[model samples]
Target chain A: MAGRSVVDAGAPLRDRVAETQPSPASVIATEIKGLVARGDRDQARERFGALVAVLQRRALRVAFQYLRNPDDADEAVQDAFVKVFMHIEQYREDLSFDVWFMRILVNASLDRLKARNRQQRFIAPAPDDDERPVEQVPAAEASSERRLLARERWEQVTRAVANLPDRQRLVFTLSQVDQRTPAEIAAATGMSAATVRVHLFRALRKLRGVLGEQA
Target chain B: MNRREEPDPTLADALDAYRAAAWAEVDAHFDERALESQRQRILQKVAQAGQPARVLAFPGTTTSLRPAAGISRRWISAAAAAGLLVGLVTGQLLHVLPGDAWVHRVAPRAAQPYPSGRLTLIPAVATTDADNALLDAIDVAVTSRGASDLRAFDDLTFAYEPR
Candidate 1:
């Protein structure tokens, strides 16, 4: 009877173990929580190193479009990552971690942009030599030649985006570049859906005109 | 520039293609490895600071009685010190009494028999109640100059019935 009782207990234990396997995101969150709770410096460093390997490049790209400066954009992405780890407890399981993390990156970038703008009245435009003008180049240029052309086109696009009003720029970047839906952009930017749509429409129209002039 | 004119469809297509190309260019310029290294360094610094260990030990829990206990102990100690100060002052004042003659002047003397008047009840006046008249008489007796040695009246009890 004792052996039978022991077997019964073991069966439940095995079932419970099977029932409790964590998903990848949850596991990551749990490991982060544990590191934070234990103040485990080495583990935290490794975990963050892994997380950054996964997330940093994408975050930098997104931040750069908003901030324009490579250094500022890098700082913004780093700051956002730190904030994400620090406030991991507040992360809801229902949302995609990438979306949640990107939201932080966007907000951090925007905040830095606002602060920099307040300190300096204007964001200095990248030098004309730094920007390769797509309009000046012939379509039949060599592959190596077209690389410079691509760079110039991107520079013009960046300038056109920067010249847009703040709301329009934010909406355009979040929607057209980040691939966020209108609703997501509205939620992220604290604008109404209709307002976000209007901003997006105006931005696209302005960008079209700018590109058209160059063409 | 004309508001009423329809937008050029070819221009719209070109803009879309340009936007896509722009994002690809931005992505190509991003340095992932450098960002990862920075993130690792920040995490290392934070972990070295010991915040995670502290947070883990009391995860979701606030310091319960520990903080209140410390505050309360400080308050009690302060109160005890105040009480001791007051007691010392009182003891000193008690010990530093006046001279013997002054004590004799203040202390009661040997009792000497004296004539006393009985408290006769007066009928209630048209404007005064029985309770009020009695209270006024007692007040007058208590305030009189020779009423100092009225020991029986020291712990006087007055009883009144509701009218």
Candidate 2:
């Protein structure tokens, strides 16, 4: 159970949140909500920079894990942040803001993916640039032969993960990349806990098989 | 949600290494400077989204929208001048046509002393029987084409005039 707010009725909200489990990002979200509700949007925007700073790297990581393209990931993160600020009025303070935000980020990524699919039907895809980040990762490590082998394994794993069906990919990425639990994944994706667990098991089984094949 | 799923320690370790390796590459590429750039961009987008949309007052005629504002301006001025000239010509035609010519067309014959000192237009062929032949003649004359020349106007006779 993800209980967000524990009862501490004594201190002020901000003071109490300093040591609480609600993250700095969630606390910033709450403050921004108050600033927006009070019609102080300029101050809210000022506070929103802090929120973006707290969440930007994590958001980027989740997006890059999903998209594999840095540019698309950047765009997805930007769109999600803009949407969060635009619809800040609808946010509920009692629930976990991180979960709410991750849901928005996931939706934004899905929209970008759909748009890319439509665009690909008309334009012949270019040979993927040799300068891709995934291909460039293992070049910096110790032995030359070892680096080549490591690159091959990483490429194989990436391909295997990419080939998973959309739900499985989502479940696996949120679980593996974003470090979300089955319960959190259920909340973010609107799937039931049992469904999240089922998808998680299937994804893990397939990935393990891929690792076994490599071995 | 945060509880580590303890299904298999070896599998979890491998997956954790995988996750770590993936994020390490991310951190290598997207460094602090890159993250700051992204943060600034997100804040920029948020700021833009907060403001109300700018509405163009005259979308078509906006200077910014035009390919050649100077050329378009000259054309617009020329069009306005042409419109004004056409309007002036039409007004002049209307003014001149209704001058001495129209007065002669519908003017009364030398106002013979009306029974009262004031000018009066009396119906000529008064009838109690309700049929008005004179009115029928006037209607036909009014509806018929105007005389073809100025001489035609002079030849037009008013039946009510004294012979």
Candidate 3:
């Protein structure tokens, strides 16, 4: 096994910040919006799949950051896409469709989180029950010792991120996981840009402390 | 101060682990098949939501009595007849019930023309052709053609008086 630390096994990240050019999803969404305005819901729905395909992975990633469980994240994504189609008319064409869709996805995730909290109050889970469906990708090349250490660090990181306050977690996930700029995060989240940067700073500072303790 | 513009290098490095682990889990959980299934479900849900909500018709609460489109004319006639029968039965039951409370009546003490005023009605009897002819004679004189026609009224009689 190659001597790869947790830092070395980085996720294949997409540079969404550099996607400044016009998005094809926005074009499709605008066309669907027009069809919906004309009362041609069937045509609008027919064209919505392209939009879903474009945003599904990113939506799942953002949703998963809020709702740690994969199934809940999936449900949240579905809810977001359905909401997008149902309320396509509300999407302002002058703005980026990604921001509008991200807003919906975040709201859906929060809704799932709230629903899960309500359910948990009534039905508490067992102490040892692993609530998240975290399937460890089998990096067969890594030695057993390295794999174990990676998994342990993974758990610690996940727990630290999960323990953050909702806004801090949101900003961190958007900035780190989704690679969105602070300005973009503010637009999607409805927070002021300064507020977004402050949240990001707080989240990073907290993570640094958490990792330092773990180290 | 400008260092604050860039995130701390150590913190960035530490965050990679979380990003890596989270992405691994997301990718493992939402594979191609799972994503496709989710896509289909989203489409189905949107299609369902795009349509109007289903309304259940409750007879008691509905404000408009819209005629049932599927009902035939014969059925309508039968319904009308059944309704008529129910009304007639209700009317008969009201009549036979004790105290006759359904009928509003004036007291006999209050049933006079003016409480104590006198009035009379003639006794009814079957009339013969002679009676009709006498009435005709009276009518001819009373019509203002001439009072000389009153001569025919001389033959008029109560008829039973002679009997």
Candidate 4:
């Protein structure tokens, strides 16, 4: 009777965990948590460093777009990693640790923004270097013209993205800069998938309009 | 594309290209130097976190309270002797003071009845609520004065006959 009761309680949990194969990030996080549990803190810390290396560049990219200043972005990323290590024990084994870490990163960026007490600056679009008289570039240099136009378009797109409402900007950065999907972004930002899609659509529409107007 | 219309594939393609270009530019801006310095700072912080905090000290600077190199051991011994002598003299003076008996008397006078006087016994009665409240207040006041100070004043009382 005891054996039957134990199986009834534990079988489904084991099956469910097995059914969803853990991602690499989740696997690494679990390993770190295990090391910490066994009292091998040094090994856990080393593994955590590896995890940081894996995520740091992407985290910095997302943070930088959210906070225009490099220093603030750096601080936010560092703060996020520190928090992740401090709360590593709280990580759920079933969930993707990447998304969890990203959520912490997003909160860290917002915290830095609040701490600075500065309104998000709407950066004015700089004058296009490609806007000089078409005659300046010889008609034969088609590649150079294409490159110039691309540079011009890129600037306009960045400016438009920068001017978006903070939520839309956050959605766009996660989607575009970090290449996260709408569902993943929803998980990271604690918003519904529908909301994330709407924000992304609105952001893209604004960008398209800016480009069209420039063209 | 019309504003109300669905997003155009061409526009999406262009935006994708722009995103790539922007990422490349931003990635390049984070150059090797900046990335290395930031990484070093982060690792330094992590290493520091794992260990106990150290008080910041300048290089080659000693935090010890020892005297300078020129000061001899004889000087140190002399200073120590001086401190001990001063302490002993102070203790002696305190022992000879007029109120010294108060420090030595461990038995409170109230705890033992007045030694040489005729003792009057007040009949035991249930204390009134007002009397209990007053006693509680006194207890609190004595407790707040701390155990050592309370012991020092253990013999003192407020009970006295009006003239």
Q: Across residues B57-160, which tens digit of lDDT does each residue of candidate 3 receive?
A: 77654435344533566698899999999999988987787632432232333333433222222112213554466567557656664555664675684435
Give residue B160's error in model 2 in angstroms. 44
Q: Name the regions of candidate 1 deviating beyond 4 angstroms.
A: A1-45, A118-152, B1-33, B48-163
Q: C-alpha displacement of B157 in model 4, angstroms? A: 64
Can you give the TM-score per candidate against the true fold? 0.51, 0.65, 0.63, 0.58
Fnat scores for every prediction: 0.28, 0.43, 0.61, 0.19
A best-first ranking of the candidates according to their TM-score comes to: 2, 3, 4, 1
Task: Give a tens-digit lDDT track for model 2, residues A1-215.
Answer: 12222121112322222333776787899999999999999999999998998888889888888887788888998998998898887776766677778878888888788888899899998785433354454445567675565556566667778889899899888988898877667777777767888888888888778877877
Candidate whose TM-score is highest: 2
Q: Sort the predicted structures by DockQ, highest score first.
A: 3, 2, 1, 4
Q: What CAPRI class is candidate 4?
A: incorrect
Q: Can you write out model 3's per-residue Cα lDDT over A90-138, one digit (the tens) per residue? A: 7766566786677678878888888999999989774853444434723
Per-residue lDDT of B1-163 in model 4, one digit per residue for the tens?
1222446765665566556665554465576677767766766676677688777755444534344643667788889999999999988977787553543342243344435342333222323554466567667755674755767566486656799
Candidate 3 recovers a fraction of native contacts equal to 0.61
The DockQ scores of all candidates, in the order shown, are 0.12, 0.25, 0.29, 0.10
User: Chain A in model 3: its TM-score?
Assistant: 0.81
Q: Which structure is stronger by DockQ: 2 or 4?
A: 2
Over all chains combined, what TM-score does candidate 2 have?
0.65
Q: Flag regions of model 3 displaced more than 4 Å.
A: A1-20, A128-145, B1-9, B55-163
Model 2 local distance difference test score: 0.73
For model 2 chain B, the run of ten residues with the poorest summed lDDT: B122-131
